[model samples]
Target: LVASGIDTNPWCDEAKKQKKGDNKSRKDVPTDAATAAPSIKSHSDFAEDTATEDSDATKESLASSFGKIVLWMGVVAVLAALHVYMSTPLTRGQVVPPGAWLSYCGLLPFDPECENAYLNVNFEGKVIAYNSNRDVAWEMQGDVCAAQVGSCVRGLELRDNGLIFVGGKRIRSIRVPDKSVSITPWPFAEKPHLKISRK
Candidate 1:
């Protein structure tokens, strides 16, 4: 018998083919560092980065809040100062004659009613009259009160060009011309019932 049919091991042949394929696949995979996927950061490193970002954000927020507070405070301070300046009287120093005389009355220093009325006479004999709102009603240059006069009235004299102020301790009644009225010294009281009557 001739050995025409060689010993054929199909299973062994198939096994050999599979082994070659596995080797080829392994060789195809990238082995170079440049071709590989980027390495992932560790959990600790990621946590640290997040913490740093959060801290920076918090600091920025705090700084912004502080700046806003300071700005508001400055605004409030300015408003307060303005209010005080507007409400306070402008005259300073002695209020008695030879220096200056000041008289005012009303609920508020700026009230248009009797509250804001004021009469001032400076040392130079300059007389100024203001309405309740501190508006200059009239002004003149003269001695308003005679020597030893304590109380006075301001109004238009019969033949005078403008209003005149007269004051004296002995003076009692006053006579005003037709269509003219006099302003008495304000008692510096609240809600005073002031009258402007014809004489």
Candidate 2:
């Protein structure tokens, strides 16, 4: 202890030495541009690197997003294909109603030969009927009459010999007399219009 009640020892000397060392270290490291240039360049480099990383991340995210979109588009296309396949009409093992088959086939264009066969059909039972056509296959049922008249017009008698019936509803073929009973024109057809009356 000293007269001023202060400790005068090696510990006090160490404190003074630490203060001097701190000041000297600060002076040794310059606060000017010359010393700060490296640090400034380093900071700029860090910023540039961060920007590059962000750009890469953005590109990766976009690629991932694009991949997802493509996958969804593929899924949509597959669903559409499935829908078309399921919606198509079937024959034989697949049974379609009389009216639905008619409407569906009517939308498709008919063969010229098929239409031409009926051009000269004027007599009774002369209508050439078909179960299957280029556009549709039908399971026919019930008697067909002209849209104008509910019954057989033009003296067209539906006899057993004139119409070839299998299971009653299905008509295999039609036979017509050489002469028509009436002079009126009748609209009769095969497949869609050659309607057979179910017994």
Report lDDT (Cα) of residue 111, candidate 2: 47
Q: Model 1, 185: alpha-carbon shift in Å? A: 13
TM-score of each: 0.36, 0.30
Best by lDDT: 1
lDDT of 1 by residue, 1-71 (tens): 13787665886799999999999999999998867778878999999999999999999999999999999
Error of 1 at 82 (Å): 2.1
Model 2: per-residue Cα lDDT over 44-93, one tens digit each: 89899999999999999999999999999999898666544333432222
The reply for model 1, stretches above 4 Å from the true place, is: 6-19, 30-40, 91-199
The lDDT, on a scale of 0 to 1, for candidate 1 is 0.49
Worst 10 residues of 1 by lDDT: 155-164
Residue pairs with backbone overlap in model 1: 105-115, 106-115, 116-132, 117-132, 149-168, 152-167
